[model samples]
Target: MEWMSWTVPTAAFFIVIGLILLGMTTWELRSPSVLRKGLLPIATTRGDRLFIGLLGSAYLHLLVIGATDWSIWVASALSLVWLLAVMRWG
Candidate 1:
């Protein structure tokens, strides 16, 4: 139908996000200690910060991007919750 224009731009936007995530992942791997601190400065170290950031970022992107598609949004939200639970329990 007339989905070409919308699809192209949406795909491009998602691709850019993917690239940014890739860069962040690479940086995180190289310097995980930098991410240990929680955003609010809890007693966390660089590793914890990185872990939380990764989970939070995924949570945010999934919530916003998948808003129109509730199923995906829920999946993303659950993942975030799961990550937080794991961190707290372990």
Candidate 2:
């Protein structure tokens, strides 16, 4: 059987995600989240905000890539900003 090939960037991406999940799990175990309202209409916990941020970032990246002639770097930067904003105030 052939093994899957992994590139450095791809591996790094997964590694970062794993680290975030680990950190979140540890934080949750130490102190559970409480629902709070932010800029988003509904109250959300940390995990909910994280999920929304990640999903929004995906859509932002796709929209930027599909609807514009911007470089991937630009899309990535925009997605990062969106993710941060969502996590902070969504």
Candidate 3:
């Protein structure tokens, strides 16, 4: 445990991921998902859209960091917006 070197952001990130997974599980149990087409141009289930959104957000952050001098907060905001859009209408 001492060797793990867990920082606040790292711990928070993992905690958020865990919470998202738990929430998705609960939502699934409450109401089953069906595949449907959206702005993504392909049918996808809720889980699929979630995966895509997360992946895309990662890339968006990386792209912003690597390609510009803007603050990470901007990238984070953009990623959050993208994630919400995908989850809502992807």
Candidate 4:
């Protein structure tokens, strides 16, 4: 990680993402998700929703970083909320 020049925030981001993927995989093995309709027009499985949420979060972070001077943690929190919302009721 040091050789990669990984900063704390960058490391933390990847760690959290890795943990989320692990947890989701475990949960899926225990109780597989069925495709279902949510707020998103198309029916989606858990993996689909997860992908969408993460992709959207990336975009959200980029938008905030590019358009504003607020702390990156702000984007992190907002992305977390967005991910949870999509997972729960997308």
Best by TM-score: 3
Error of 3 at 65 (Å): 0.7
lDDT of 1 by residue, 59-83 (tens): 7667666666557556657766665
Between candidates 2 and 4, the lDDT winner:
2
Off by over 4 Å in 2: none
lDDT-based ranking, best first? Answer: 3, 2, 4, 1
| Superposed model 3: Cα runs more than 4 Å off | none
Q: Which ranges of candidate 1 are over 4 A from the true structure? A: 1-6, 35-90
Clashes of each: 10, 0, 0, 1
Number of the candidate with higher lDDT, 1 or 4: 4
Model 3 reaches what TM-score against the true structure? Answer: 0.94
What TM-score does structure 1 among the candidates reach? 0.34
Worst 10 residues of 2 by lDDT: 81-90
- The RMSD of every model to the true structure, in order and in angstroms, is 8.8, 1.2, 1.5, 2.2
Give the winner by lDDT.
3
Residue pairs of candidate 1 with colliding backbone atoms: 33-46, 35-46, 35-49, 35-50, 36-45, 36-46, 36-47, 36-48, 36-49, 37-45
Model 3, total clashes: 0
Residues 1-90 of candidate 3 have per-residue lDDT tens digits of 368789998899889989999999999999999999999999999999999999999999999999999999999999989999999999
lDDT of 1 at 37: 29
Model 4 C-alpha lDDT per residue in residues 1-90, reported as the tens digit of each score:
356688998898899899999999999999999999999999999999999999988899888888999898898788888888899998
Per-residue lDDT for 68 in model 3?
A: 96
